[model samples]
Target: MLELLDLLWTFFKIGLFTFGGGYAMIPLITESVVAKGWLETSQLIDFIAISESTPGPFAINIATFVGFNQAGILGSIFATLGVVLPSFIIIVIVAKAFSKFATNKFVLGFLRGVKPVVVGIIFSVAVSFILQNVFSFSFKELGDFIFKWSTIIIFIVVFAMTRIWKKIHPIFIVLVSGIMGLIIYGLIL
Candidate 1:
């Protein structure tokens, strides 16, 4: 009971404070979940991957998974509700006031300020993930970095494919990358 309430409060706080959707929320989620010992960094990474692969919002998916992992189905319910409640309330408030505020300069300025912050958060998350998963650094040599050749190759291929065939869906890119991962890591060595 206490644990479930804790989950609810924590997720509620996460959802309330997090802006700019899931990618932007990664750092906050990492801090809260890791600090609470709810999930390790590796587990959080896995949760991120699973969340991306699954349907609905990534943050909500993570909340549900973490809740279920902690205290079963009821926990999942509480955590999900907690995470969503803030968004629901805010949307209601925003919807009611949007007409009045639509042309307000202060509100417009505030939103403009927020766009850069959201972009910065998303870029930070991207760089962190790239460093963790795609590159290795060497202590022996200053400014030396080791790259995973296979992963780099996959990245190049995916980038080229996406650029060349603009209509290709992201799922195809995911599938291709998965197959490449299997071949490179699973069967190569």
Candidate 2:
């Protein structure tokens, strides 16, 4: 009971404070979940992958996945609601007030200031994700080995394919990547 409440409150706080949506929320979610020891760092990375691949918003998907892992269906429901509630309420209020403040210079300045902060947060999140999943600095020799040309090539190819062939749904890419990884791993080891 208390655990559920804590989960709700944590997600609520995250949702309320994070702006610029899912990408911006990643750092906070990683910090809150990983630093607090609520979930393992590896699990959080898995959540990010799953969240990105699935339908719906990234943050919501993460909240649902974590909540379900921690508790059950009810936890998933509560966590999702907690995460979305702040955005919903804020949007409603902002929609009502936006017209009135449409020409306000101070408001415009505040928003402009926020954009860089949000970008910084998202960039930090991206760095963290890349470091954890793609790079390994713990063991010097192994870390050097991990940066293989094949893996780098795969990343470049996938990135280029996504940019150029925008019509390909992301799931297909994920599936193909998974198969490629499996085949490569099998051949290497």
Off by over 4 Å in 1: 137-144
Per-candidate clashes, comma-separated: 0, 0
The runs of at least 3 residues in candidate 2 whose Cα sits more than 4 Å from the true structure, single-residue gaps closed, are: 138-146, 166-168
Collision pairs in model 2: none
**In TM-score terms, which candidate is top?**
1
Candidate topping lDDT: 1
Looking at model 2, which ten-residue stretch has the lowest summed lDDT? 136-145
Per-residue lDDT tens digits for candidate 2, residues 1-189, read 887887898899889878787778766776786677778867776666676687888878888887887789988887888898898987887888787676689978888999898988788766655554555533324455257665666667777888999999867788767766777677864
Q: How does residue 78 of candidate 1 score in lDDT?
A: 89
- C-alpha lDDT values of all predictions: 0.82, 0.76
